[model samples]
Target: MLKIIIAEAELEPMPRSLRSLPVMKKKYGRKDVVLLDSNYHHTSMQTLPDAYRRGRPDIVHVCLLNALESPLNKDGGLEVYVHTRNDKVIYIDPSWKVPKSYNRFVGLMEQLFSTRRITAGDTELLRMVNKTLPDLITEVSSGMPVKVMHYEGAPYEPDPDEVLVIGGFPHGDFVSDLPFSRFSIHGEELVAWAVLNHVVYGAHGT
Candidate 1:
């Protein structure tokens, strides 16, 4: 299986600091956990550190949608995980159909963060665990080669059963030190979802 880890994703609930903001309180109300979205909370995020790279749940949403809908996943050849900036890892079931609506997607994420799991009857479709990126890699890699996607790295080629790490934030370098081979499909920077699509379809040969 081609396991993928979207490391340092910007997906998270509204931080405690931002919870009291007028915009947040007005939009999300008194919910204990609300998904932090740059589109909806841009002004509030500016005061936070590394603001440019934060508050982008849309990136994660797009990446998940692209990965889960790909032919490779349907064929049982792909596995995906989302590792957030807060050191939370989201385990995804390949059969889970991500909500197409961005608003609904955000709601689902808020619920997941609040409840820690989403189940479809008896099967768990999504679950959040407290895990660092490196730990997640070690658990899922299982001796397969680990590759990090970067524009300045070595030329890329599809390798079966390898674990790939792609940045899930909108901008800036990874916050964690990823000790893995970096590979590139393009010389210029591409958005996370775009790179994911290219890699998934390229691997799927479709």
Candidate 2:
């Protein structure tokens, strides 16, 4: 049986989906998955010297945004870095540069933003306001005082399975922890939502 330990930056509480991995494995037949939690603070590092004192991990999966931003050196240990690309796909790379496909996605976003026919204020409103604006011109034509405002902005279509991970301390430090793992890291929210749906509906299914 392969022993796998997942270590993540202790930002927020462990996600429920990730917390349930051990149960899922036991119910199925994979008795090798283990979930571990760790923060990037100094206190967390103090616990590390004794956490894995007995033996090193077969696979040390680091679930962080930019692991290579500050390359890690784990003597003789196999380390993997995973991150979610701007397009929401999990990318496992040993270096800092994003893949060619991610670059293409960024290019597409840039083109879309450049061609957008709206001002910054309107764009911000489009995301903030949820209701359609009232027709002020009709009221003005009816001899009633009315104000007309043109909010030109494209509609926001967020991915359905998109999960926003917000983290903040009592002071002001904050971070958004994303899922980026080789074992399961791909697709947009559709993939994650599908996996959650499966876990919910097909828990008994092999």
Whole-model lDDT values for every prediction: 0.89, 0.23
- lDDT tens digits, residue span 1-206, model 1: 78889999999887888998777788768788887778878887888888888888889988999999989999998999999988999999899999999999988998999899999998899999999998999999988999999998999888867889999987888878888889999999999998898888888843
Off by over 4 Å in 2: 1-66, 73-89, 96-105, 108-206
The runs of at least 3 residues in candidate 1 whose Cα sits more than 4 Å from the true structure, single-residue gaps closed, are none
lDDT of 2 by residue, 1-206 (tens): 00011222121222335435555445434323222233222233343433322111111111222222222211111122111111111212233232235334333323333332222442321111111112211211244222110112122222212222211111121123322212222232222223222222221221
Residue 81 in model 2: shift from native, Å? Answer: 5.4
Task: Show the colliding residue pairs in model 2.
Answer: none
Give all candidate RMSDs, comma-separated.
1.3, 22.7
Q: Which pairs, if any, clash in model 1?
A: none
